[model samples]
Target: MPYDTERFDGDILFGHNSLQVVYFYSIENIIRGWAQHFRHDASKKSFYHVDTAIFEKLWRWARRRHRNKRWQWVKKKYFPKGNGRSWSFSGEVEGKRVYLFRAGNVPIKRHIKIRAAANPFDPEWELYFEERLVYKVKETLDRQWQRWRLWKEQKGNCPVCQQKMNPETDWNIHHIVWRSKGGKNTMDNCVLLHANCHRQVHAKKMTVLKPCPV
Candidate 1:
């Protein structure tokens, strides 16, 4: 992620929040959105095909990082050269196929925003989008990123109750180790749950396991 240094004045620092912008391909992501049926196939091989903009940006970064290196060295180390032909990156991962994809593909069509200043307790900030086409951006982009990460990690099921969580409404993040106890905000420390299930866990009615199983 790039730093907010005076409106695009700072260096473009890549990989600050890499997980937010890079996604693994899943049935939920293909077909412009999610499909009703989806599963990970371990037999497939890993593949990567980035856009032109991404390719250029990465090449520029590589060049800057390896200022004294030859162009051939840069190409060999940075870009993928398969069969001495295809420049797209691809490989085998433990005899299984994986993919690295670009981010921010989720749709956000027509919508409305409201900031109710009178509601002191909540501020009543809200956004509404056309259900069939758009997503309602939550309070923060980090929240949305976490939602997508958890959704992909758990395959859209709440670990607490083993139930399907509503994409737009039901899911919530729970910290395995609380921030007050020195828990850092990372995938390993966070788990997704339904809002009710979250309450249940807090009430001692349920438990969540680290490295949550699907």
Candidate 2:
């Protein structure tokens, strides 16, 4: 007697790929399993089967239109690139012709590193992960201030005036505000002056020279 295989329907058990025919308790479980297997392992040639009869009917209808279109699109857009050869769907629902690279060639470890560095707050991390670069620079006058600390200790006076002034009482940070009112926070914009010289610069009682912009 020839064993007749009826087309799948909502509640029928159908054997696939010579496997044991088992009734699935729910269609949802079968569909979910198909999605997971497809994402993780299905490639240019791999696919899975749904034993539930209703799903099989729906799958056949879908295969004629949407599935076939998607398979064609995948071949063009998302196909893996390496050799000159191209891959296409074999249309088999089980253990189809598929290509698998060696485990070492896969970028699983690099993907792990990317996931680790990802910032949770960034929405882009939900798509892909990468790192940001940052740099910091210090101004020259700030460096000079540290070098002048020894001079203040020895002379206790403004370098220009040579008048005996207390280090704590006279030394002040000055900004040579520009004629265009462009004040900079750089060391060149600053000068160590005695309190009187500092007041003179601000009060404009003496010549107010604009410091060169660094």
Candidate 2 residue pairs that clash: 8-53, 9-53, 9-54, 10-54
After superposition, the stretches of candidate 1 with alpha carbons farther than 4 Å from their true spots are 1-137, 211-214
Instruction: Give the top-scoring candidate (TM-score).
Output: 1
Measured with C-alpha atoms, the lDDT of residue 210 in candidate 1 is: 64
TM-score to native of every candidate shown:
0.35, 0.23
Expressed as tens digits, the lDDT of each residue in 65-84 for candidate 1 is 67999978877754556534
TM-score of 1: 0.35
Instruction: Write the residue-wise lDDT of candidate 2 on 138-184 in tens digits.
Output: 12233555326533443454544657666445345544543224455
- In each prediction, how many residue pairs overlap at the backbone (N, C-alpha, C within less than 3 A)? 2, 4
Q: Pick by lDDT: which candidate is best?
A: 1
Candidates' lDDT values, in order? 0.46, 0.37
Go through the candidates in order and give the C-alpha RMSD of each one to the true structure: 15.9, 24.4
